[model samples]
Target chain A: MELGPYLILASLEGAVTAAVLALTAVGLSLVFGVMRVVNIAHGEFFMLGAVIAWWIAHSMGGHPALGFAVALVVAPLVVGAIAVAADMTILKRLDYDPERTIVATIGLLYIIQQLTLMTYGPEARPVEAPFNTRLAIPWFENGENGWQMIWPWGLGTTSYKLAVIGAAMTVLLGVWVLMKRTRIGLVMRATQTDREMALAFGIPVERIYALVFGLGAALAALAAVLIVPIQQAHYLMGGDPLLLSFIVVIIGGLGSLPGTVLAAILIGLSDGIISVFFSPTLAKILATLLVGLVLVFKPGGLTGSSGK
Target chain B: MSAKAKIIALHGGLLVLLFALQFVLPAYHHGNLARIMVLASYAIGYNILFGYTGLLSLGHALFFAAGMYGMGLGIQHLGLSVAPALLAGIAAGAVVSAALALLALRTVGVAFMIVTLMFAQAGYLTVLYFGEYTRGDEGFVIQQAQRMLWGIDLSDATNRYFAALILFATCLAVSLWLVRHPFGKTLVAIRENEERVRMLGYDIFVHKLVAMIVSGTLSAAAGAAYGLLFGYAGASFASVQYSIFPLLWVLLGGAGTILGPFIGTLFMFYLIDLSSGLTSAYMLIAGVVLVLLTLFAPQGLVGELRNRIWRWLP
Candidate 1:
């Protein structure tokens, strides 16, 4: 009812958007970081994850949570494998020439999107969340009782939405640790820093590329699986994620993970708040405009290093 | 035959074929031919930038759409004739694209592509934002009263066909001239190596800027003609799909070659048209063709032909 409570609600909603968007965008940023390739099909992989989640959940015929959990584990791996295959077949064959690969990935995007369209049909399908509990949020009111806690009417949120935020953060943390602490991450870093030297150092550079590409797709798929319950799965759902991912990646600086997460939160939070208060179309228009301006003014991104 | 003579013969033969076909073909078939001509012209404009200049822009749809809307609105609101409306559309497209190119060309490689894509998308939203006038996703049709152009009824299918043919021919000839010109050679050189061109003291930015404006203007002009002839222009015309259409056409036909866009457009249009009724997997063909072409045949049909036989095409 009050402005404070409404703003808080909007931020909470925005956090959910940021959480999913970070996972998707961080993947895009990471792929560009290591592979030097903008994986245009990245969003299609996200779309695939949602579609797969729906299929697995629908077919399992078990408790919704069980299906969701199984999907959580299965979707990313499946999507990751697909990405690896694409990297090998399409990207490697092109020798990863930056321009050629963009076209190749565009081809990949259409291939994956059309395949899903043919198999999944044109309709949007809802995925039942494992748990659906409405938790009413209380807002503090200064009354005779002195700062009494009052349950805000119609301001309750589902438990599942909150879980998505927690889950995405946890996954993002895991990714951070995996990248910083793991040996595989070191190899990827080495390759990014200098590919020929990495190869000379006995690191299987090509193999690491496969892993990184797969990792990017897996993250996108994981984000998709997480949000499919909130938003229905559709064949044509990849476009927005792709567009938003580009916007985030550009504004955050292409290869900077921290910058990406920060930018995602910035964009996702604003998008949610704006969509809630204003029109979604306006939100999209502003976001796209912001990206164009950022690209023109700050070619390296807001926090990204220069000379990119 | 001399390469120049061969080129002229090819152009002359194609022009005659198009002119003669409209009379024999049914009205529906004639309309399809007009679409091919206009879209091929669009692809030619795209080829000038991507094929000749070595810039791969994914945002040409914004320019194309600007033309469509500019012409539609000019005729409706400004009460202009078709010729001036088309010019207004071309000017709108050229200005918008030139401004956008100035900003987008600051970044190279993937950044440039993304910037263009974002700007095009922004343009699409802007069109939607003014949905009242545009009808947004529903699109706007040119409802202006048809007038005579040189004593010919403009609304007649035959007249529209001839007009489109003339537009396509002019664009093709201009593009041929540009590609053969020393200025066009500098673009090819830049595409080959920007650093070397820079070392040679040529202004790469100015050349690229001009190339982009020319490309955008041509695409936009074709778009204006398309809208006027088809009698409608919608937000979809300004969409990513239209942008990709030109890329696909140029890639499949031949990027640098003058007739590559035309060949690619005809081949693709027929393939998609024939396959659309048979299967829902029409786009799959396009995707596969693009992937295969990028991987195996980067030179395209005309480029490949030049690589082997038909060396006189230029």
Candidate 2:
């Protein structure tokens, strides 16, 4: 109703986008960081997460929370397993050659997409959020009787939306701690720093790579699961996330997790605000153009060393 | 005595066979053959950059779409005759590619690829954004009047096939010459090792930029010819799928070889045409083939054959 309420609503929406985008982009960045291979099928992994969540939720046919809980755990696990299998079968065999891997992943994208289209039946299915408590937001109004607080009509949000943001932050914190403090994290960091040295030190680089690939995919899946309740799951829903995540990864610098998160927020918030205020097309154009500029002027991104 | 003469004779024989096939093959399939030839030209164009120069662009669709839409729209909107309109379309492709290359060629490896992919996607988005003028997804058509060139009607099916054949032959000859030329070898050298090429006192940037322009212009001409021959131009022409298709063809047939693109185009086109009848999951086959090809046979059918069966053959 008022400028304050509208801005708040837009930011809230933007926050949700940023939360999910951060998770997905972070996964992409991590994969790049360790493997040094751009997973073109990363978005497909996101789509798989959403679709599997839908399938699991739908087939369970019980309390929405129970289905959601199951999906939240299962989607990421299944997607992660798939990624490991793909990495071993396809990527490993190729020895992770940059160009070939891209083509292979492009093929993987097609295979996954087509399989989903065939089995999933090309329908955009919606999943009910575990909890959707509607809370009306109050707005301050300059009434004749001094400043007054009024519950604005339609100026409300679902509790699930807030939960998404909180849950994502929690997971992100968990990831940070795991990367910073854990033995596996050290191994991964070692692998990222020097694959040859990591191997020489008996780190089992191949196994770590498989695990990292799976972990990266799982993160993307988790994000998809988080957002699927708000946005319907569809077979062809991978392209936008893929492109946006690429932009995020590029802007954040390809291997920097913190950079990915930051760029995600920057892109997500702007995307949300711009789309709400103006046009989605304009938002896309701006993001793409920004990526081009970043590529030309700052290819290393905001956080990482000059890669190119 | 040399590989040059051998290649020339090989091409000459294939050209005769193709010409003879025109009569022996049924008339109903002429249009399909024509379509194959136009697409083959694109593969050849793609091969110059990817096969010869080792630049794998995901944005070749910009040039392809430029040619298709430029030619179709030029004739439709400008009311220009066929030849001039085709030239204009080709010029547009070269210009767009050169512009993109100026920016993209600065980066090498994966960055170059993703950059090109983004640009191609941007072009597709631009087409959609200006949907009113470009007709967006619905596509556009060339008028019959504009299809006439110097009293000869390009709208005629036979004429269209011959025109496409001529274009294919021209591209093939030019490609054959280029590959044999020292300039083409330089591109190959750059592909093998850019640093070495640079250290040899060569201007790699200029060479790469020129490769992009030449390859892009040919693709554009092929795109325009496809639109002119079919009398249709659509948004799909500007899509990433189109870009990938040419790459697939070039790779599948043989990337650097003159006959590779032709064989790849023919094989892939036929496979697709055949498979599209049986199932909608036909693209899965392509994806699998691409994966297998990339892993096992990066050189493609012709390249593999040349390596194994006949080193002297083109």
Candidate 3:
């Protein structure tokens, strides 16, 4: 009811959004940094993840937790395999030329979206959360009682939402470790730095590219799976994530993981907070224009990295 | 025949063929042809920037929508006649493109694409936000009474066909003239090597800006003409799908070729139309075609024809 509690509620929602966005944007940033190609179908991979999660959860005759657990592991792997197949079949043939990659991925986007529309149908379907318990949040008020903690009505979140945030953080941390402390990451980074040099050093650059593309797509799928319970799985749901991820990648200074995460949080939070003051559509319009202006004025992005 | 005479004869012959087809074709195909010509005009406009100037914008739909709304709003709100509303639509496109070019030109490559896409997204949202005027996604129709143009009943099938043809021909001629002119050649040269063009004492920014304006204005004209001819103006035309349509058409038809847009539009329209009859997932066909084209026929149909047979195809 009060401003403090409402702000807290919005922030919590924003945190969930930021968590998902960070994963998606980080996935995009990784692909862009390593491959120097934008995967326009990244969002479709996310949509596929959600749709597959729904299918898995729906088909498995067991407890919701069991189905969710299976979906959590399976969806990303399936999406990753698809990404690898696409990379090998299409992007590899094009030699990862920037313009051609864009067009090709756009085609991939259409195929994936249309196929989903055909099979999934054009309806939004919800995935039952593994466990959902509404936990009321306590707010402090400086009253006659002096800093009394009071339970506010409608100031609560589902246990599943909190778990999503925690899950995203753990996954993001795992990704960071994989990139920083693994040999495979070293090979990928080396390839990213100099493809010809990596080839000369016997890095098996093409395989590394395939692996990286798959890994990036897997990360996006993972995010989708995590969020699918809270947000319904829909055929057209990928557009927002795709646009938001694109904005985060650009604002975070293409390829910078830290920048991507930070930008995602900022954008995600602002999106939630802005909706409190303005119509959701107006907020979106403002955000889109803001991103355009940022790109126009600061091509290098806020992190001061030369994207080129 | 001389190359010059041959080029003229080829374009002239194509226009004549289109005109003659109106007389003999059935009503369904005839209507589809008229629609194709207008969309082809949009693709031609896209080609000016993408095929010729090497600037791949992902937001031509903004200009297209601007034109449609500009004309539609003028007639709906201000009660302006068809001709002035059409001019108003073109003017709106010019102004919007000029402003966008100034900002968007600062970025190059992928950033440029993203910028235009973002602006277009904003434009689309803006249209939805002002739903009272635009009628949002469910778009309003322009009545037959409002569809008259200077004593000509443009709502009539024959007149609509001729109007679309005239629009398509004007766009084709404009593109033809541009390619032949020094200015258009400079744009082509810039596409090949921006650095070299700049070294040759050309103002690269101004050239790109002008190309963007011309491309945008033509697309807007197509949008305006589409709304006028079809008797509808909708937010769907301003959407990302609409933006991608021109790109797909230009790519399929042969990006830089003069006749590529028409062929692409015609081919794609029929492909979707026929496929939709069999299954609802007709876009799957479009997706497959795009991927296959990128893989096997990167040069597109007209581009392949030029490479194989007609070196002077432009």
Candidate 4:
């Protein structure tokens, strides 16, 4: 591969990876903001989303985009509704005991994983890319010399992958605007910052928590829908990304949107570059260690307290 | 002297029974029994920090790993005999615990748990990264017989079981003693109210750090025993899942009590084994049980059962 074409490919990969990571990190941050419970099962929601999308595609005669679109909407609702139910039933009883809640959610994670195993079996389900045409640019071509990069950059993704990335960015932007500019967003921020004060100010803190948690679940589902194309759907795929996204949230500063975004991109790029240079497993180790170093040196995180 | 006499009598009776069982039981079952004893011992180490001190470290596996690897490394690299190898593992575990305690003790509550977890993961990754030296996931074997004192070789399953039982009983007694001591009282004070403990002139951080190091050291000793029994050491020894097993054992048995973790580990493993035998959906069943336990009885099986029994009696 020529340097220019490789650079373009690398950048595109960076963009897609960053988008997926940002989507993952945001949901975790949101839930932490509202409920004070770090939902260890959040990655299961992401995994379930991918599984749901794959199932939809399989059932709908292999229209992956339709599957993607369906998952984008339905996956989050299904997972969020389950989480909402959990919130109302088990988590609600725990109140704000984050430790007990952590234990409970870990138990939930295993339950979901085992259920997935029973339902889907232990095999990884392969997901086909919905769209197949690469956006190609005319380059210098020779039979013996092989094709070479020339001038104008030709960026390409199947219309499906492009659509997924586009949709994800739109959802993220919409969430940012919603949190920054809306009335409920204001309440969420206020509650996340201080629940007692918010309650004293006449806010229905319980409802806000449930809503925020549901919203976070939806975001994770969105990520799962988009991410299905990159990796096969599997019951245990959630474990790795769950650990990685947690590192992202911690390094990005807890509940800081901009920080999460920046940290996500940083982690995404590092993961991609490291995987390319070394083994994928080593990349994971490096990425985590980098986060730990940041944590030990700067406990407040990179962007340090984006308000609450 | 009377209390000491009672302890000696009880200890002698237990040793006599253990010796008798060795002759009656099949050799393999005795080995299996030894394995369970080692695991229960490991759980006890976990309970020392989690149950009594109220520190929820999700990375106790690190100490265990340290012990296992310390023995493996000592045997492989230093050509050390069994007793020295085990001692090396204990020493390594102590060093790791002391180092980790310094950073982890700075934070309290859930943050401390997360930090410890991160460190454990980091430790796992670090080991996996140096795959060449640590044999990575392939694991290393300790080929030597553990050192014998006088003429008693500990490599034999029955002898190992007796050694493990003795070590376990000794550690358990020490832990119980520590819990009753002035220092133990200070830890309880810190657990109940750290701010008040600080007000009363006790350095909460120092006490917590000490407790963590001591607990980790015992966990390390158990890890060494685990390595000796299994004869292999791998990264799985330091896995996140291994960390959770002890945490669950403590949670299910009840924290802040002697004999809780031992009972909890035995019950949990047996419940799991039985469930697996009954159906493949055992994990789901176990998960449900775990969730129910957390939601309904935070005090755990023993603690909850004791309360109910007391109520009935009253």
Clashes per candidate, residues 3 or more apart or on different chains: 0, 0, 0, 3
**Candidate that scores best on lDDT:** 3
Model 3, B160-206: lDDT tens digits are 99999999999999999999999999999999999999999999999
Over A115-207, each residue of candidate 4 has an lDDT whose tens digit, in order, gives: 988898777887676665666544464556687655455545456556666877898899999998999899999998898999999999888
Check candidate 3 and list the clashing pairs.
Answer: none
Q: Rank the candidates by lDDT, best first.
A: 3, 1, 2, 4
- Model 1, C-alpha of A119: deviation from truth (Å): 1.1
Q: In DockQ, how does model 4 score against the reference complex?
A: 0.49
Clashing residue pairs, candidate 4?
A: B51-B256, B82-B147, B83-B147
DockQ sort, best first: 3, 1, 2, 4
> Candidate 4, residues B1-314: lDDT per residue as tens digits?
46556545654565566567777879876776666667777787888788777888888988989988888778777888777888999998899999888877766665677778888888888778877768888888765354454467667676778877776776767776787689987887777887888998888878888898888888888898788766788988888878888877777887776666766776887787778886675667656766887898888876776577532210
lDDT of 3 by residue, A102-162 (tens): 8899899999999999989999999999999999999889899799999988999999999
Task: Give chain B TM-scores in order.
Answer: 0.95, 0.97, 0.99, 0.87
Q: Pick the candidate with the highest DockQ.
A: 3
TM-score of each: 0.97, 0.97, 0.99, 0.90
In terms of lDDT, the poorest run of 10 residues in model 4 chain A is A149-158
Task: Give the alpha carbon lDDT tens digit for every residue of B204-225 in model 2.
Answer: 9999999999999999999999
Q: Chain A: TM-score in each candidate?
A: 0.97, 0.97, 0.97, 0.89
CAPRI-style class, candidate 3? high
- List the DockQ of the predictions in order: 0.78, 0.64, 0.80, 0.49
